[model samples]
Every structure is written in C-alpha cells, then in structure tokens.
Target: MGELAVRIEGLTHRYPEQNADQRALDAVDIRVRAGIITGLAGPDGAGKTTLMRIMAGLLKPTMGEVEVVGLAPIRDANALHLKVGYMPQKFGLYEDLTVMENLVLYADLRGVVGRERTDQFERLLDFTDLHRFTGRLAGKLSGGMKQKLGLACTLVGKPELLLLDEPGVGVDPISRRDLWGMVQSLAEGGMAVVWATAYLDEAERCDSLCLMSDGHVIFSGEPAEQIERMRGRCVHVRDISGNRRHFLRRALGSAQVVDGVIQGDNVRLVLKEGVERLDRALLAKEPDATVEPVEPRLEDAFIDLVGGGPDGRSVLAETTPEVRIGEGVDRKAVISARELTRRFGDFTATDQVSFDVREGEIFGLLGPNGAGKSTTFRMMCGLLRPTSGDAHVMGIDLKRSAGRARQKLGYMAQKFSLYSNLSVEQNLKFFSGIYGLKGQAQDRKIAQMAESFDLGRYARVTAGELPLGFKQRLALACALMHEPPLLFLDEPTSGVDPVTRREFWMHINALVDKGVTVMVTTHFMDEAEYCDRIGLIYRGRMIAAGPPDELKKQAADADTPDPTFEEAFIELIHRDDEARRKTEAAA
Candidate 1:
C-alpha cells in the first residue's frame, strides 16, 4: 500500500423522514489504501451508495468523520472535488452530445488542458475502446457504450481517488472486463479505487472486500478469507430425482439448508454449520439424489454470512410450468424476425437477423455493447420500423399492423420508463389504462401487482423516489398489468441485488408457467441458463443461437468438458471478431 487514501470512522447517516431504525449507514469504519481497489458489496438498501455520496461531497453524514485524500470531505469539499472522481450509479452524460464532445466538455469542466489534456483524451478513448464511435451521439449508443463514455468523462482529470458505484451493472461482460482492466491500471499507477457493486464475482477481484447488510459492515477483509470461512459448509446436490424445484423447495424448508439456488441441472446449497453429515435416509426417498461437498463461491459465502434463509422465496408466486423444447421446426412461433435489418446513414444497426421464439418459451438475446440487440428488440416490439425485412408478434405483422401486434405483447424498456412524477400506484394505474384495463378490473390488477411485487409499502411514493430495486419491480408490474400473453424484458434485473434478481426471475418463471412467452435481453451471462433458448448477436448479425447447455458445449473442447455460460459467450464473440478481422484483411 502506498498511503492512506480514504479513512472513515463511526460513519452513520439517516434520511429526514426515516425512523430510528432506518439509518442508511450505521457506525462503520473503513480505510482505503492508495494503489489498491476496495470493493463494497451488499444487497439493496445496504448504504453503499450513501457512503460513496458522502465521500464525493454530495451528501453529509449525520455523524462520523470522512477523509478523502487527506482532506475532510465536509470541511474541504471544494478542494476534495479536485482530487477525486466520482461516477454515480446513473452517470449524467448529455444525450445529444457526441462521444468526443462529451469527453471534451467534461475535460473543460475539470480544467484539463494543454498537452496533458490531449494525452488524456487519447488514453481514455483507447482504454475505453470508444475511439471508433467518437462521432456517435450519446443517445444513439447502446447501454454498455454509454457506460464506457461516462467512465471516460469521469477520467478526464485523472484524479488520485475514484469512486465508482455499480459501474458495470448493465454493462456486457466484454465491456465490463475492459472497464475493470482500465480501473486496475489506474490503481496500479497509484490512484485509490473504491468500487461498489451488486455482483459478488466482481468483488472477488478487489484487494479488499467490505460486505454490508442492514446499513452495517458485517465483514471486511480479503475475499479469499470470506470464502475460506464457508469452506466445507457448501455442498452440491445432483437432482437425479427429476423434480429439482420441488427438491429445492423442500431443502429450503429444512433447518440444515441455509440457502439453495439452481445451478444448471443441479442445486447448490449452503448448509448450516455442524450439519456435516449428508442425510442418506432423506436421499433414499428421492431415487439417485446425491450430495457432495464443493468449493464455496463468493456468493455462497455472502448468502451464508447474511443469513439469507430461503431468500427471494416470496417472489415465487407459483410453480413454473414445464418448458418444452425441440417440438419441431414447424412449430408456431410467438415472435418471428425475418431478414430484419435497420440502418442509420452509413451505420447498420442490425442486418439480416432472422430468428423465431416459440410460444411459452423464454428466449434470450445476448450480446455486447453496440451489438444491435436493442435495435432488434425495438423492431420486434413495434417501437421502430426496420429499414427492411419483417417482424411478427403473435402472428400479427409488426410492419403492417404494429398496433394490433403491440396489444398482444407487454414491453419493458432497458431504463425505468414509468412516470417519475407519479406515485407507484398511480404509474401502475396509468399503464393498466393504457393496456385497456377499466374500472374494477384495473383496480384489482393494480392491487394484485402491488402485493406480488412487494410494492405495497411504496404505493404512495413517487416512482423516482423509490430505490433502484423497487423501481425495477414497479416497472415490471406496470408492464404486466394487462396480462399480455407475450412479454419483452430488456435488462430487467440490471443494478439490482442478488436477492432481487432471484425474485424477479421467480416471477418470470411463474409467468412463463402460465403459458406466457417471454423475450428478454441481458448482459448477465448467468441469466442465460433460465432461458429456453438464446441468440448471440454481434456486429449487426445473429452469430449463434441454441440452448444454453448446447452453446456452452459449442464453445468448449475436449479439455474443458463443461464450460461456463460466460466463457461460452466470450468465446463465440471472440471467434466472430477474429473471423471478421480475417475478412477485413482479405478485403
């Protein structure tokens, strides 16, 4: 460690209307060293954002001391601003400005000029891989591209300390890797980095990890140490019994099972301490069910430490319906894209993309930033007219009868698109009305949704005032108010905690079980396992499409019999990139 970059002691914060128990942050002590990355990991409402805001001088702590770069945050906020770079969860980049223009404006605002400014611009553009899209409007860029641009703007002056709040929340894995690489390089050059994230895997990369819960730091130290603490306590149960969900539900109810999650075809469980023996008698009831001790992951340890018993069970409104695959090539398609293509001037957003989503299927569109997934989604949802080609939803032509097609489908945009000024209940009512719900029907639907999504507490709260997790739930509720048979979810779980994500998926599974067809786009590779089929889009084309297990096998070789979904996704993208490079070289 070079030097102490940040120091906090007895840090506590509370909102004005909050009750005595509702402190955003409790008495917390933390020290961040220069030239290292400190990760803040926690569930929703854990106060990670609160601490970051206080460090950035955007908010004042009710009690406690905060020192950033040896300057008191409250007393020397103006000076502190000069030596620190803070990127909030939602980075404020002007939508109309081009990528280069945004960088220049931020540089000007930060007083970066001369040769240093020129060098920094080149470095940022290169590091973020945004050099190719310098002239593209910020609004025209994909979600991941916008994140990179935001990061580039924040790096204008190369401040000694960087505070990044969920910087990779909605970013693709490749872009996330690039962003992390850039941050690590910055830290190696003696800058202190504090990263708050919902992704536990990202926390494992940090030099130090701080796990927070209920506004308190329950654990803080090396990530490896945390994992070590849960060693021998984690176990993997192979479900040869053919009823994984039932087994999971039963296991969760048992006192021995701490937490259980579906991982591929098996159930990974964290058992309570001192329950070392596998219950053979219990296994005898379910033929061929076997349990084996396994290495604990960061998520397993976090869940165990936080005592998240049967966490997210409330989101499981009902049992998921069985997904039937390989019916036939002649099966009727719920969503179909035939030679879909869209272009803007010289740039092609999507090109000749053709795919079919079967009825009652959970279809996933996977890709990196700027790979045209959103453009394709918009075309299918009837939000945008494809420059050529055709799209159909529920057998209705999107190009010829978009209105009729839209009526049969529910669509959720990547960002929170509900009315910010309206209360949660009001927003739900508005959406219900838009979907043609009336009088008692709309009222009943709204009440049901409020309960289903656990939004009853925030019914009267403004949509903008709710937390990110609640906002996500409200947006989903709004989309589903009319109970459309087909649904489109774009980055639905982005920036949400693991528990919230699990809850969201449970709801999706329940809806799918009721014969609702779903089309979703996401950057999180793990989510692909839940989908019946996934299409990998890259550079304006559909490069690959298959079941998650088949896709993983395609990316694997003899040496790697079972490759992770993430590894498969990256491999496919890389292979496509290499092939494109070869074609360009030949040209």
Candidate 2:
C-alpha cells in the first residue's frame, strides 16, 4: 500500500533435494506496513523461516520478488543488510566470549564506535537486564539471558527492519514479556519487524500475521479477526485410557465435527459445525462424556486452520501408548527425585527440589529464567551430578549409577545433538550404536522412526542441511532410539511451528501410552496442559506441583475466581517480588 516496509510477490524457494516444481514458498504475496509487528505463523516445514530469510536478504527466492523498505534484498543487498537486523533460530554466539565482549564485537563489526558506543552498550545492557552478567561468558548464561544478549546484539544498530526467527523459543515468561516490550517499543519507533514463531499466543500479540503452511501462505490478516472467525464452538472434555482417548479423538476427527487436542485427561475441541450439532452428536455417541464449554484460545484457531490428516485423524490416529515396562521402583514410578540440589561455586541452581514422576506420565518442569529447572533436569538425566540429595531412574540412583540410569532414559537437549556433518542415516547409526541397539533391534526401531517422522525422505541428506523442523524431529528420533522407559526433554519444541510441535508431541504421547515416562521443560505455558503433572519452579525453589488445573488453583489470587495458568504464573511472580522487596526493606 502506502510505502510498505516489506512487500513480497509470488516468492518461491526450494531446497536442493526438492524437485524444481516443489517450492518451499509457493507464489506467496504479502505486504507488511511500517511500525508493525507482523508474525509468520505456521508449523515446521511451513516456510516461515524461508520467507523471513528471503525478506532479510539472507536468502534468494527461486521466483517472484521481495522488497524491504522499498529496496530489493538481492540487487540492493548492501542497503538491505544495513536496514535489516536478522537473527536466526540459533544465536550463533561464541560460547567462550563474555557477554560484554560479544556485544562489543557485534557493535564494532556494525561500525558503532567512539562516544556513541558506550551509550549504545549501556542502553542495550540495561534493556536486557544483562549488565550484571557482562563479565560472564555467553555460554555460561542461562537460556533466557543468552537469548536476551542475542537480541541485544541484533539491535545494536537499530535496523529499520528486524527479522526474528523463533527468537523467544525456550525463553522464560519474564524474559518473553520483556522481549515483547522491547519489540513494541521498536515498532512504535517505526521499525517494521517480522517475527516468526511457533507459539500461537505470541503470534496473537502481533499487530498482524501471515499464516504459512506447506510452503504457502494460507492466511494473512490481524490475529483477532482470524480468531474471531472460529468463535463460540470450542469445548473441553476430560478422559483417561490411551485406547479410549484415541477412540474419542478419532471419532471427533471423523465427524468433521471440530478441531480437537488431547491434554492429559482433557481434550479441547472446536466445532466446525454449530455447538448444538456437536453437543447432539457427542451426546448420542458417548452419553457419559463429561463435556463442557471452555473459553476459546489461539490454539483453537491453529487446529481449525491446520486440522487433522486427510481422513481427519491424520495426526491423532498415529498415537502410540506410553511404554513404562521395567523392573525397579514399582514400574509405575519411573522417575523419583528427593531433595535434589546442584551448586556451582556460590550459586545454588537447584535448592532441595523434590518430585516423583509416574510411569507413562508427561511431567513438565517449568520455571522462569534462572529458576533452576534446567539444572534439576540435568541432574535427573545424569548429565550433571547433584551436589547433594538424590534422583532415581527406574529405581537406579542417577549419581551412583549414572550409566545404568542413562540406559533407561532418553534425553534431548535444547539444541539438536546429532552430528551436523553426517547424513541422517549416519546419525541414527551412531546413536543406535551408542545405545548398544544392534542388528535387528536397531534396524527395526530406525525404520519405524523414519516412517513416522518422514525421515526416509531425508535419510541421505546431511543433518546440517535439513530444515529446523526436520532437525528437531531427527534429534527426537535419536533420543528415542534406545526405547528407554524414561525421557527427559529440555524445551524440545522451542523453535518449531505449531503443527510440527503438535506432530512431535503426538509421537511423544504415543510413547507415553507405551509406558515411557517423560519429563520435559518448556517456555510455552500452553504446552503444560499436555503433562500429567507439572512442577513450577521460581528462584531455585519448587513453588507448585500437581495437575495443571490444581496448580492454576493454587497460584490463583483471592481476587480471581478461576485464573488461567498464565495469570496464575504472573500472580506467583508478583508475590515473589513483593516478598523479596519486604525482605530487602527489613534488611
């Protein structure tokens, strides 16, 4: 329209292995206004990243044209680069360098110097709240702090156009809030930003959005309108048993009735038809069903847009039961932790944390940045030996029998741990061997994983060459190669699209049914619903633990009748702040 900050017409990009006709971005056309936050929302392999890269001048389209700030990214590469700040899913920070050193290096490389440098650095550090950590190495900082530093480095020169590719993935709620505040301020200052994210709620916060799917733009407009279009039809129902849940989900899918998702004992459904029809149908089919109308959310819009498979139960139909068969600590209690603690010098990362994980349960360890959730997880998985206390996996002590504990546990870190230089098949082989999964057992497991995750299509492709979604899936497959009774996932879905996340969790849920115990950490609060039990950490302490609804009740304030998890979380943090302030005043 009037001097668009970003304009794209018929843009297309295909990977080297992809057929020439198969485009990652198929004839996509869009325009982003100045001083606005435009979200590129979609599942993994949806081409949001590709589209952003093209607009940022980091990539060239196979067809069509893109212009940022009225200049072509390719032909006007230098000008576009100067006006744009591009941050990939990964920070690309030097782990050995201090936060200040990294910032200074980035600033100097961007030609910022002299008197302006000091002011710029101070302003950035203050905004990120990383001034105190300036002397700490980038690698040593917590996940949220490192992400803030990355954002600070990108904003060093205040480029007119900012392309953030999943920048807030794995970030804590407080850090996420802070980052969004910064984004709002930048947009108000007339800097157009294109933020690609898998978090639907985050996407809902944008001024506008472009929903990409299968390498094509499915919808583009304000998120409010998009959400409103699917209103008054969503409902939630709670249930148990994998077979029954699967049956219900399939039934819901077959009816073309509405969008549905399984959240441990609860399934959220959106009626494609009217609510009356959905009610009538459900009542007729399962008269005993405990169904109630719940407030709709962005996830409803996501399910409505993405949907199940061609037959309706495409994703849900592939459910596999959690596998928890093993001898030790009553197979039902797959993971047990009692007063776990880890200390690094003067810092106590985990402070007497205690929790028990049932076999076949999706247990989530959640907290804000610096809350000690990761440290606790590492100890449980035997990655880090706790300074004191205990952690047992399938009845084996993590500290005393780290090797045996590891054998029964599948672990996936924040980053993809597979070899980048090797092909997908090679990575699988390497991990299989490490787990001692030899001959027929390994081959059978690999084949099943390949088919389910669509790894066969990219078996020959180098792990490094795969897209972010594929990389995540491969990492997951590798982790599960051992078919362990327990799983520890640290923000496994941090940077993937909604569909990819859903798909990945679909597979995980299947494993849960087969008795696999999962303990995962995630920044996406909504994902907490999937866990059978949840532990909320704050300032190195376990503040809340139980079912999501129970914790929500516990975290709720006297003023709110029924607070959502996000609201409860905010309330808890505010209370913590108040208590800290009171302690300081007394001191």
Candidate 3:
C-alpha cells in the first residue's frame, strides 16, 4: 500500500435526539492510503455521509481518534483545512455568479495566486470541459455541469486529500464517466481520494471499498473478493413477451428466490442456498422464456449481505381506491407532441421534437447534460410554453388548455420541491389542499400516505431532516396523492441506493399494472430497461427513439455483439457529436 493519508480508530457519532437509538456511526475504523481511490459504499442512513463529514472536519465525532495526514481533524481543523479539499453532497455554489467568477472567488479564498493559480485554473477548466462555459451563470448550467464546476472550485488549493460525497448523484452517464476519469487521474498524482456513493458498480471500480450498514463497517477489502462470495448463486432469466413485471412478482414470491431485478429483457435473480437451478416448468409457462447462469455483481453481494429482498409494498396507500383508466379513454396515445420547439433568445432548447406515449406504457427520455431533454419534458407537462407546435396530454391540448391538461397528469420535478421546513405530515396536507382535497378527505389521505411510505415514526420530523431515501419516498407520495391517470417523473431515482431503487420501481410497476402511464427522465442507463421505449435527445434534437433492445442492436458495431445500455448511450452520443462537427465544417 502507499503512504497512509487518513486513519480512524473507534469512530462514533450520534445526533442529539429524543430517542437513544439514533447513532449515525458506531465504532467504525478505517484506513485510507495515498495514490489510490477508496470508496465508501452503503444504503441510505448507513453512516457513509456521517463518516465523510467527520473526516472532513465538518463534524466532530462523538468518540474516536481521527487523523488526516498525521493531523487531528477536530483539534487541528484549521491546519488540516489547508491540506484537505472537501465537497459535501450539496456543494454551495453561488447561482448568480458566472463559472469563471466562482472559480476566481474560490481561488482567492484559498490564497492561490500568480502563475501557479493560472496553471491550476487552466488545467481544471480543460479537465472539466467547462472552458467554453466560463461566462455562463451557474444557475443556467445543467446538473452535470454544475457538479463539475463544484469539483473544480474544490481543487483550487491543490490539496493532498480529497473527499467527495455523492458527487455524481444527479449527473448524466457521460458526465459521470468523465468525473470518474478525473478522480482517478488525481489519485495517480499521489493524492488520496475518498468517494462516498450508493452505486455498487462505482465501488467495484475503486482500489478498495469499505461497506457500511446500520452505522457500522460490515466489510472492508477489494470489491472482487466480496463478489467472489456469491459465485454460482446468480442467474439470469429472459422473458421475451414483455411480461417482466409479472415474472418479477412471481419470482420474488418463491421461497427459494432471495432477490430479483429486471435488467434489459431479462430478470437477474439471486437464489437461496441449495437451490441449484430454477424450475424448467416455470420457464415453459411463459412464451419464449429462457434461463442461464451468470456471474455475480457487487449488487448481488450487497443484497445478500443486507438480508432482505426488495420491498413489495405499493406506493399508493391501502385506503386509496384502485386507479383505473377512464372508460373509452384514448389507449393509443396518452401523450402526443407534434413538431414541438422551444427557444430562448437566439438559442433553441428543443427543436422539432415529436413523440407519442401510449396508455399504460413507461416511456423514458435519455440524454447527456444540457441535451434539451428537460426542455421537451417541460413542454409536454405544460410547465413551459412551446415556441411553436403543440402537445396533447390525455387528449387535452397543452398549448390551448394547459390547466385542463395538467389536471390529467401528476408531475414530480428533478429536485425535491416540497417545503423543507415543514413536517412530513404537513407537506402532505399542503399538497392535498393544492390538489383541491378538503377536510376529512385531506386527513384520510395524509394518514394513508404516512402509513404506506413508512413515515409514521417520523411524521413530525422536518422534511429536510429526513434521509435521502425517505426524502424520495415523500416526494413520490406527494406526486401520487391525487392518483392522476398519467405521471411525469424527472430524474426521480437519482442518488438512491440499489435496494431503494428496486423498491421504487416495484411501486411503479404496480401503478403501471393498474393502467397508469408514466413518462420519465433519468441518468441511470440501467433504468432504461424498465421503460417500454426510450427517446435519445442531443443538442436540442431527437436523435433516436426505440425499444431498449432495438437501440442496443443499432449501437453495436462489428466488434461488439451486445453493448450494455451505458455503452450504447455513449456510442450514440459520440455519433451525433461527430455528425454535428461534420455539418459545421461543411457550413
């Protein structure tokens, strides 16, 4: 191993609360070395963020010995600040400031100047691919671009140790790849990097991983060694008839199935011990079904260690009536956009975009950062007026009758837009009132939502005080309170853990089964498989649209037989970029 950069012994942290079981970290021990990237991996409320905060000297541990580069974090925080660069999950960037202004401000605060500062600034701009956007206001930048700018600002002083908390949370796939590349390069230059994330795939890429669960360190070693424990237990089953949800429900019901998830045209399962193979009779039940053994992933090991399968509860409360499509509803196209276009000043955000979302279908919109997917989504949801053309939601014209069109659909924004200072119960009541609910009806709905979302214990807790997973659940509950026939979710599951993500999809599948149509935007490429179809947008244009399998086939060249969704997405984006470059040259 390289030189030691961070060391912790018997670290413990607890928030002051009325309850005694509120420990955020319990006797955690860790060692981080220079010249490599270390990952802190776990589910929500697993103490990863708390540990990172302690290490960064932002929070003092309740009880522990912590040292960073031989300096005590708490006692010598002032001295350590000069040697460490820390970026919290929510990095504070001045929204009104231009990108260059923010960089300069941070550099000045860190006391960086002269030729050394110029050299560092140039390298950071080049690495983050933000040189062209130096004059753009931070408020106008895309989610991924903002993250890159935050990281650039954090590196102003060229610190020896870097701590990033869920830096790639809402970032797109292409941007996420670029961020990881920059991080690896930083580590190679003898800097120690500690990255906290809920993504197991990312953990597998780290030089070493520390797995946390329930406020304690459960495992610490190489990711491959952890995955090796689940060898021969993972299996892949294909259902070509598009009955993945039905198959998933059945598989999870079985006594031998420990965990199951829908991956592109297939369901990956982790079988219980002594179960060598799935019953062939089950495969014969579904038309064109097949099964095969496959290697285990870090997620598989994580599920096994967690000791529970995906939660099967419906997102809607039990007290709520079952949702049903209106009689004689337009089953062919629940949503339709015809030649939609949107412009700001001289720049076009969306250009001539047209698509149709059928009833009960889960449609996904995918793109890189600043690719105009959000613009198209906003027009369809009646949140923004199109510069030309029209969109119809549930047969209601969005341009002519936006209020009526909005009544037929539920919309969840990219960020958690609920009132942060209000209690969870209060937020539900507030939304209920906004949706025209009243008196007994509002009270009943609030009670049902609290029960369904498992928020009863924290009903009085402020929405902002909840963990990331619970925050997502609360947002979803508010969106579904009115039970509209159609739902619009914009990056709903970003920054969520694998288990919580599975549970979220389970609820979505349940809703789809009950005849609800969903249109969503997400950066997680694997989530594209859950949608019946996907549309890829690039530079204010719809470049491609098709089912996941069809898109994968189109992306595969002579060398690759079958590319993963992420690989396919990258390939398509690169092709579009190359085409645009050629057009500009010809012009």
Top candidate when judged by TM-score against the true structure: 3
What is candidate 2's local distance difference test score? 0.79
Residue-level error in angstroms, candidate 1, position 6: 0.9
lDDT by residue (529-580, candidate 1, tens digit) is: 7787899999999999988878888999786677878988998999899999
Q: How far out, in Å, is residue 307 in model 2?
A: 3.8
Against the unseen true structure, what C-alpha lDDT does each candidate score? Answer: 0.85, 0.79, 0.88
On lDDT, who's better, 1 or 3? Answer: 3
Q: Please write out the lDDT profile of model 3 over residues 1-587, one tens digit for every residue.
A: 67999999999899887258778999999999999999999999999988988888889888989999889988898888888999999898999999999999999888999998899999999989999999999999998899999999999899999999999898888888889999999999999999999988889899999999999999999999988888888898875585888788778877778888877778888987778888765565586777778888888888888885664556463344556766765778889988899999999999999999998899999998889999999999999999998899877889889998887788888888789999999999898898889999888888888877788987999999999899998998898888788999998888989888887888888888887899999998888889989999999899999998899989999877789888999999999889989999999
On a 0 to 100 scale, what is the lDDT of residue 369 in model 3?
83
Give per-model TM-scores.
0.92, 0.91, 0.97
Off by over 4 Å in 2: 1-3, 15-17, 238-253, 263-265, 273-276, 279-290, 309-328
- Cα displacement (angstroms), candidate 3, residue 166, comes to 0.5
Question: Candidate 2, 342: how far from true, in Å?
Answer: 1.0
Ranking by TM-score: 3, 1, 2
Residue 325's C-alpha lDDT in candidate 3? Answer: 63
Higher-ranked by lDDT: 1 or 2: 1
Backbone steric clashes in candidate 2, count = 13
For model 1, the stretches where C-alpha displacement exceeds 4 angstroms are 239-250, 277-286, 289-292, 309-332, 558-561
